[model samples]
Target: MSSTATHTDDDLMTVPDVLHVLRPLSKRTFYRWRETGKAPICIRLPNGELRIHRSDFKEWLDSHREQVAA
Candidate 1:
């Protein structure tokens, strides 16, 4: 799938999927953010895998947007 592809809220994104969108950022940093409550909220599966909802990720990204002077 292309990086620009849109995902529904029901779509669960894997770590690689997020890493794909957040290129140039390391997995270590991603985990660090997750640890510090700075990353998008995630769901832990019974098998101990993490999944992030598209909506939550979008919301997290939107929250970080810096308003610029027009």
Candidate 2:
């Protein structure tokens, strides 16, 4: 398979990567929210790995902003 195909098929991202994308929030805060069920829902892959979809995270952020504005 081509490199793009391989990467597209494996679009899962790690917690650190998500943290990098959503900076201003500490890694410890993310982990704490994850543990407390306050973080965005995550997907558990067949290999027992955890990942957060970028689109879902963005949706969560938008909804949260709306809630705060209300």
Candidate 3:
């Protein structure tokens, strides 16, 4: 799929899926954020997969918004 491609509505994104659309980062750093409560909320499936709602990820990003100096 293209970089701009997005999941269909009502889709639950896997950890790697979410990372694909966002900035690339090491899995170590990503999990560190989760442990420190800095990353967007994630849920673990009964089968041990991590998932996040696209909408919730957007909300989390919005809440952490900051201005950058040009």
Candidate 4:
């Protein structure tokens, strides 16, 4: 199989990467979302680091899409 077949698995993102893209203004705010179940599904590794699958993150972002008045 070509690498593209595994692209989905290779695109997992860390919390910092997600925050960088979302730019929600603060880590506290993101943490609050996680705590309140407003954020996307997050995976907690046995070592304690958090992970978010790329597809799940995109779905979460799309689900919360809102237009802001420019």
- Judged by TM-score, which candidate is best? 1
TM-score winner between candidates 3 and 4: 4
lDDT of 3 by residue, 1-70 (tens): 6789666545677888767866577778888899999888888999988988888888887898898999
Worst 10 residues of 2 by lDDT: 1-10
Give every collision pair in model 4: none
User: How high a TM-score does candidate 4 get?
Assistant: 0.75
The per-residue C-alpha lDDT of model 1 at residue 26 equals 89
Q: Which portions of model 4 miss their true places by more than 4 Å? A: 1-10, 67-70
Which portions of model 3 show Cα errors greater than 4 Å? 1-9, 67-70
Clash totals for all models, in order?
Answer: 0, 0, 0, 0
Using Cα atoms with residue i matched to residue i, what is each candidate's TM-score against the true structure?
Answer: 0.86, 0.61, 0.74, 0.75
Q: Whose lDDT is higher: candidate 3's or candidate 4's?
A: 4
Residue 59 accuracy (lDDT) in model 1: 93
Q: What is candidate 2's CA lDDT for residue 60?
A: 66
Candidate 2 deviant stretches above 4 angstroms: 1-11, 66-70
Provide the lowest-lDDT 10-residue window in model 3: 5-14
RMSD of each: 3.2, 4.8, 3.7, 4.7
Q: Write the per-residue lDDT of candidate 2 for residues 1-70, one digit (tens) a residue.
A: 5565333423666778778878877989998998998887789889977797766676667767744455
Q: Relative to the true structure, how large is the alpha-carbon lDDT of every model?
A: 0.92, 0.75, 0.80, 0.85
Question: Which pairs clash in the backbone of model 2?
Answer: none
lDDT of 1 by residue, 1-70 (tens): 6779765888999988899999978899999999999999999999999999988999999999999999
- Tens-digit lDDT track for model 4 on 1-70? 6665444744779989888998864778888988998988999999999999999988888888898999
